[model samples]
Target chain A: MSQSTVPARGAARTSGTVRIVGAGLLGASIGHALTALGVDVVLSDTSPAQLRLAVDYGAGRPARGDDEPRLVVVAVPPDVVAQVIEQELADHPDAVVTDVASVKLEPLHALRARGVDLTHYIGSHPLAGRERGGAISARADIFIGRPWVVCRDAETSSADLAVVEGLALDLGATPLEMDPEEHDHSVALVSHVPQLVASLLAGRFVTAPEGSLRLAGPGVRDTTRIAASAPELWVQILGSNAEPVVEILDVLATDLAAVADALRHPDAPGARRTVADSIRRGNEGVERLPGKHGQNRRFAQIVVMVDDTPGQLGRLFGELGDLDVNVEDLRLEHSPGAQFGLAEISVVPSVVHGAVDGLTARGWKIASMPND
Target chain B: MSQSTVPARGAARTSGTVRIVGAGLLGASIGHALTALGVDVVLSDTSPAQLRLAVDYGAGRPARGDDEPRLVVVAVPPDVVAQVIEQELADHPDAVVTDVASVKLEPLHALRARGVDLTHYIGSHPLAGRERGGAISARADIFIGRPWVVCRDAETSSADLAVVEGLALDLGATPLEMDPEEHDHSVALVSHVPQLVASLLAGRFVTAPEGSLRLAGPGVRDTTRIAASAPELWVQILGSNAEPVVEILDVLATDLAAVADALRHPDAPGARRTVADSIRRGNEGVERLPGKHGQNRRFAQIVVMVDDTPGQLGRLFGELGDLDVNVEDLRLEHSPGAQFGLAEISVVPSVVHGAVDGLTARGWKIASMPND
Candidate 1:
């Protein structure tokens, strides 16, 4: 248990006062994390109520006229990011300006089009956020253990880039440098396209009969979980990173068409092979995902039935602790109409048998043991 | 806590010995539930080891020569369902034979093509299963409150249909009747296609650069989680339900192409509107999904971060109990390289503020509050 508490990295490396514009999830969360690390943070937002809520939640203090911020974090929406960055650069001459909006290329192009001095402005995106937005959903640790991509160009100074990386580190995130084009394309493949695909797939459920939805299983729920995200925000995101996203979507659409056509004519020559190949490609794709801690190793899962009553899960965890079996990951599944929960605990493969035996001995119902 | 221990509902309604072929997840789960209800259950499988394991898990006893079964459950792989159902029906002449295969139409068509007697056979699919298969993963309560779709034809007698529905009820499932075509089309829309789409999207991650997946977030994880399902099994399911699934996939493919082309030429007329319209459609689609207890009403979510320790979650849940707030649903998010877990608790909208305030007062870090 003690080993689980790894030391919080990035505090000592992060120094100086920072000012954040926009009291939304990213900006406010950065404020909270910096404040927790004893770094002086001043928060500024156009929405006074939002600013007040962020301050009340211990995110940061209101900006003061005398405060000389060494770094200005422009955590605004994607569409308005470039304008805000331009404005921030003009307002704070000495401070390095960095924006946390998802897309980087559009903002850089916009800033370049406006002929703004680009040396002091660094484009960075912390790959961390929740479905819901605003300061109310902000967490100091939201960026912890996430990758923060810093889009740096040749014109950007090393000192300015260092400051932005320090900011990401201070918020407990890893900073990786990438060219704007590469970053945009990477996010399109990994993040942007996945989001749109989820939304589009979930859209199929809209006109489905209510009875059809009653048969919706975990597969459908998980596939569309992110579809519940705000569409207005996503429209802006997909709009900004349209090129790379569309490029990937085009390939996916073509593949889908081919697969559909093949399935349409299964009796056709090579149709079954095509179908099998597509699914096999999917198998290869999912296998590429890094496991917990980026190890890419498989863990055995033990599904235990948990009664709805409180302390049942507590008791289960307590027993697991007593058994000295570390849980690598945990997922609690509860269907809409079900009264109980299914606690799927992922643990090291070596400890599975012992964990199962111990739990069964304790009268805990082991619903499923996949590795068995 | 006491109220949560609702009496198991299916025991009193279930009667007679049920014979289940294929001691896998669905079959073993059915056997377990019926056995718990004090109804006799006879288990069979080609694999002696699987049958022994299911019997050891108390799912049921081995088949006896003189024992008579009132119901015959043919639970096997989708590709083998038709043959298995034929065998079960032929073996148990007086029994009402039903199958729990995911696809209904293909098997019915295959059986018709084989000229198998159809009078005692009823096609049913219980919308309950796990990503992993086999008896070891089976849960007696897997079908509780989930919809069980029964496909009836003109040859099916009313008494045989009632027996199948009664079996569904005995397993605590809501039985819904649909024609074979309707069932196949609906599952394709709600189940089969989602599975294929998930696989295809996850496949995109395979060729992605190593650094790109480092930026993978919850969206990517949720979208691809179902792709981890056994590929060989999925190949069979998609193959068996190929026609309807192909029809749905064709339409989806067309939509993807349109969205892609519109994104490709964003400056073209109506491109942005096309993008926004697609996302808006997704919002409407996800909004149609039922919430807990099949209600469409929304619930407020409160994300509370708990230190990653053995009893941390237990303590938090215990506190929730003290506050007397019933958790409508719960999901735990734990990332690698992090020392804490985020418990996203869903509750009635009215209780959101109080729950947040109470947990905060108890020194829990409320990472996000949906309702503010």
Candidate 2:
């Protein structure tokens, strides 16, 4: 087996090398980030074209010597991530290896079944992605600030865990230690199921009359944004995490039925109550949500008349810094005739009104005052 | 009976005055936009304080000299919108009177039953609002670029339609002519039902275990943002548009049930097919939605490592403009290390790779690339 000697722990870790297999988006990105940090990176890919693309993107040079690198990251499709990781382990017995797949349980199970060296293999899934794939799409900063879920069981060696965690740290991502099952279940609810819901909502418009679709606005766009995701990737995700995703869908179905019942029987005494109850529940759910970066969700709106002049709207937002109101949402509409524009700014609500009044008193023509 | 001489048809039309009966959010905003356009605006409200607030915000002066305004807008709570419109019609016989209520058919039917002069009464609903209410929240440009559904029946006169359309135009809103029934049905599917659905989803989080709520991000926030709206207003809207809203909900419920059945029996081939079908349908729905404004929906993720320094992240966005990549979405995650931050920039997929490469070449260290 290929081998290399490096300083043991406690010596200020100097430049070391990593071998990235499968020069795809994840692998190339890792190589790019590591290389930027003065780490020597050698990348290997089955496709010479992809390897060249990764190298061209500054991910790393093509693998050179038979010397074993300290780490190997197998960044391939979910179906092949496990196999590649196993192959890498057998090919380089000394290197700690990990796979950056979306799903963790199946890969971990595969390794367990194959009786791979428990100490060198760690399973990880970074909760981040884009719609496009391939080496050409790779970027160094993809993992920064996102959660890198590392699945560890009793068999996972502390040294391997440290290596994976160090890699996550190097990439500027939060390393979250979680059980494989828990990670799958959480994603099924927050990511997979929601994607289905968005897709379902968007699908309705596909068959809508032409005029009907033209009238569609930001609301529909926001709801169905995630529906544009890669279907093949989603199929694999939903297939593997089918149980939990289905469970969440079941809950959504029940809730939807209750709402339908309430709407159907509006004239009944309980109709209004049912509708209100559902709305109230929604309010509670919204309140439970964490705001930006774990902050409390702030709500606000700003209404300003937009002139037809180019860059006029941009200037308005720039001036908002004077108000110190964090704009959380915004909507703009122009009057039909020769008139000024109207822009509604939604912020944290705490300072939105004050900002409106401030701008109004400052010779900025206010559109409307707060109703209350 | 109050009467005024009508300006000669096709004569240089005199500037039309807008009379807002209640200086609430909608009323004050209408008055504000009209007054800003140098049109005569007269404001009135049961609460002198509210009326005074509207006037102070330059919405309009009080009605004067038994003057007959060309148009009267009844902007009040849903429960009173119809009554107020009827009263305004009685007081101003020559004015084209309309109501800005969320529900249309009920108010239109109520006026018809009251034997009000249908020739002069038009029903309109401005599909725009905020969670906050009152003149304090009113803005002149609130309706700009938003659809303002104007409902007309056989009894509506051309002159009346012209006046109402002019008012909508003056407010910088797109005037959509629809039958009252059709308007109600469309809104029930797109607006009212979605509100209820959001509320129901949000409610589920209210009783969730501690820390569960913290997991909510943009998805839940976006889905339930409207849920924070006034419950009482929704009650009136849902009650009035119960029929069509219920119909849509019923269909949704049927689909939901099918999905639920699929989830419950995942092992069964038929069940699996149903589940897949539902997901596929959802995907189709998502694809039909128009991108932001009229643009195609493009998604890109840029991972940038940020330091603790304030405004460093802001500079990155500013630099993105230099690269000529439009950022459509953004998310940030701070790792455990105190010194670094990761800002993920999601742009149109077409430009994501270029942007990432440009930034990396510029010497800003890259983090992790998003998995495709």
For this target, which candidate reaches the highest TM-score against the unseen true structure?
Answer: 1
Local lDDT at B80 for model 1: 86
Worst 10 residues of 2 chain A by lDDT: A1-10
What does candidate 2's lDDT look like per residue over A90-117, in tens digits?
8888888888877778777887898877
Candidate 1, residues A166-207, lDDT tens digits: the string is 777666677899888888988898888888887888889888
Deviation in Å, model 2, residue B304 alpha carbon:
7.6
In angstroms, give how far residue A275 of model 2 lies from its true place: 1.6
Model-by-model lDDT, in order? 0.80, 0.68
Chain A alone, TM-score for each of the models?
Answer: 0.92, 0.79
Worst 10 residues of 2 chain B by lDDT: B1-10
Please state the CAPRI-style docking class of candidate 2: acceptable
Question: How much lDDT does candidate 1 score?
Answer: 0.80
